[model samples]
Target: MSWARIMAPLSGGEGDATALAAAVRLAEPFGAEVAGVYTPADVADVMPWMGEGFLGGVQTTALESLKEAAAAGEAKAREAMSHVTYGKNAFVSLQTPVWSGLSAESRLSDVIVFNGDSARGRGPLAEAFQQMVADEQRPVLVARGEFSVGGPIAVAWDGGKEASRAARLALPLLEKASRVVILAAPKASSRTFDPTRLQAYYAARGVTAEIDILPDSGDAAPLLLYAAGKVGAEILVAGAFGHPRLQEFIFGGTTRSLLAAEAPTLFLSH
Candidate 1:
């Protein structure tokens, strides 16, 4: 499928540009419209409340400060949007109550792009990433670090629906890649597609790919990432694998616990 409209949520965080960069890079080959969305905190929600007394001057001052903070975030987001203008269709939107606003916007867009900093308790960005992955179940582009994005894509295949879904969403990038490597974890329990079959599938699409079975290491996810990196891949496409349990996949379930600078930009679909 082609990505005609891409929505990137820019928090103006430590590595927000990675998502913006991925969206812009993908847009060039597909001519997609990139929208840089900013979701700021709600001032009212963070304001202090009295049990049964009227508001005082202190509370009023605190409310104004929170409003200014939110406004400042929006301003920074607007400024960040200026750095990316490759397709002549880049735009920005500052949203409120981050999670709900972004989730709603994601429904209207083809893909949601965000920084892959999914550590628990980090902030709203992490929470939004989890909600979208677990609740929304949409295709997400998690920018782990700086990446070429359009070149040398690696598909972390497990023969499951999630894996195939990720591959499908990543088709535009894969087609444009100088090389595509199908990385498989044979030990993965829920596999469905075989490398030979996947190879033929890509062959029909006029894309040549090399299939390599990763060793049955103790941990499959990190090893899979390791193999993809070894192949000089710039992007790693994988399914957003998740199950209802405390323990999750190596690449992190919807929580994105596995993101790191060393890892390539991830194109994940569940």
Candidate 2:
């Protein structure tokens, strides 16, 4: 499989540069288009709170302030995109209804990119990240600390549907890796499956992978991280497991642990 477009949602925050850089790095190998999408705050969302007959100066000033902030954010996002000097790049400034535009762009793109802050729910694009991964079920690459492409990559597999989908969607990236390792803990879970099945699957696609069966452990995140580090992997491909609760996502144990750790770049799909 080949990736044609990579979407990076820029929030005009500290994470924009990391997200854009990672997008460019991924796009360089396949000559994919790096779409730098600027998601500004939507002013329409606050209109209902102001009441119906509240077209007074207070509302006017609030609206103006929102507009000015949006304008400034767009400018910052554009400046961040200008620094990316690899592959095809496009700067897109979303309109007032920014969420809809972001969803549309993410659906059309092959994979979405975010930085660690956004992925960890500590940035302006945190909601966007959650929406794309949990609601839209889009693949995302959480770039952290100088992401490197074409390096040793690791895949976390458990023979589940979610893991299978993540492995399949990450085929394009796996093809570019210098080495691929599949980390599986067969005894850690209740599921009975073969890790070799994934190995054979990759082999059939002209991608050779080594399987590392981890020992029985209560948690799989630490083992996966250690194994990835042992192999000097710069990227880890895994499935994101989470459920929606009151418009927020409650991630699975392993997924949450991985997100909290300072590990490799994560390529995840829900």
Candidate 3:
């Protein structure tokens, strides 16, 4: 296992459970530890919905609701841990206001998993994924409905340092794959790279992988996904990129699109 530990931020529900399962499956292969960081409800997300943040009864009720949700989420994490076969589990209780605490937690872990929650657009999970995987530059596995850890691995290679690092970080999964394929996008400029070099890099690590160029088409996400489908890859691993201007961050071209991907889980890093 390339990762010594992987963390799943539990939001309580099926998505969290699925993420936990994915993390455990990945961790177990290398005897890595799995930690579920439970953050039930952000006070900001709840307080606003609760209407006019107040004191006394209203405040008490809100606190109680938060506590109940937290407890249930912790229970869910514990239950999921119980079913995991090999990896050891640890629990973390974090109720961060702006998700800063969660972000900090991510820095120490090898990989983080969460649901895409794309329908909500740039919601918390989506933004958090971008923040961790793209902004703070960590490897993250974003899942939606149902996700399984092992299968033919598809890697999106762009020949940049980020993509190279991401491939290196995902070596364990690639090594385990029955088949490995690289999806390289058409280069927009003369400073282009050949995917064959990446394939050779993997060769040194004893992973047999081939490269395929995706259609230089309209939407990046769909095109990559379509190519991945052609290769029958179960999941995608890519390097995420984004930059901050003013107080906001703009996600990398393809990275933003993958956040909305539903069919396959995305394993990404910065």
Candidate 4:
């Protein structure tokens, strides 16, 4: 059986309810479970720094805001579940860093759903998003405009451990795809593609695969994006490059451009 999970960032800008709703729809057929996450509002000022007379007011305001946010999250979670089609089965839960302890648990999920914004909890631009993908070693799907996830899929492969991992992770969805394009791109080290070997890999798994080889260009992101769109790919799955220590590689040029691109990306990092 196939399973999927969507991580709603829970913020006014990036990880909000809209993305969660779309994630719910995407997970409908798979009967996936979804989790909502929100960063609690800052209350340190009210706790020890405020005057005794004003402390009560500050505490009340903070509590009210927290309640509102929690209520909104619950309502959105309910709404997301309402759109499910495959027997309308989905389990929803809310978690946080200090209280609900969701932050620790997100590392264990298979897939995380995040937004492009920087300030919305641990989103695509945040370190948590990268950790969720590369460090925690899971696939992260970033939500963008129009939220169309199911369609033609593009698989970026270099025959490395990372590329193979991405291909394997994408197998479930690839089997469901009407068309699957296997893209072999240029990388630094000595890497070659054995069409026969790859064909056997897919053949063994019952996937009739179509392959293409592209030149090693300076920027792989745009090239991959262009190729996917040309093939009418709605969901693009690729092995994410860049070392976790190098900020330039993680949140810098290539990653930013790819995440900012029009297509919804399923990223697996090495």
**What is candidate 3's lDDT per residue for 1-270, written digit by digit as tens?**
477888887655666666777777768877788888776567666666556646678688877887787778768767766666653888787765647788788888998877666222443355566567656777887765454455788998777777788888898888888889998876532338889998999999999998888766654577788888787787888876532422323533666666656667777777
Off-target runs (Cα >4 Å) in candidate 3 are 42-72, 75-87, 95-100, 118-124, 144-150, 187-191, 242-252
Clash pairs, model 4 backbone: 7-113, 10-15
User: For model 1, where is the 10-residue window of minimal lDDT?
Assistant: 249-258
Query: Cα RMSDs of all predictions?
Result: 3.3, 1.9, 4.2, 4.8
Candidate 2: RMSD to truth: 1.9
Better of 2 and 3 by TM-score: 2
lDDT over C-alpha atoms for residue 29 of model 4: 54
Show the lowest summed lDDT stretch of 10 residues, model 4: 116-125
Model 4, C-alpha of 239: deviation from truth (Å)? 1.5
Off by over 4 Å in 2: 242-252
Residue 93, candidate 2: alpha-carbon lDDT: 92
Ranking by lDDT: 2, 3, 1, 4
Candidate 2 C-alpha lDDT tens digits along 71-178: 998889998988888749999999968889889999999999998888888878889988998889999999876767788999999988778889999999899889
Q: How well is each residue in 1-270 modelled by candidate 1, as lDDT tens digits?
A: 477888877665655566778778766667788888876665545534543443678776877787787777777777777777675555555444556677787888887877655423255577667666667878887766567645788888777777777787777778788999998877654545578788788889878989988876656677777788898887888876555524564434532434544467777777
- Residues 158-235 of candidate 4 have per-residue lDDT tens digits of 676766777887776777778888876655226666645665687788877787666668677777787887888777
Residue pairs in candidate 1 whose N, alpha carbon or C atoms collide under 3 angstroms: 159-192, 159-193
Error of 4 at 37 (Å): 3.7
Between candidates 3 and 4, name the one with more favorable lDDT.
3
* Pairs of residues clashing in candidate 3: none
Candidate 2 global TM-score: 0.94
User: For model 2, what is the alpha-carbon lDDT of residue 248?
Assistant: 30
Candidate 3 weakest ten by summed lDDT: 242-251
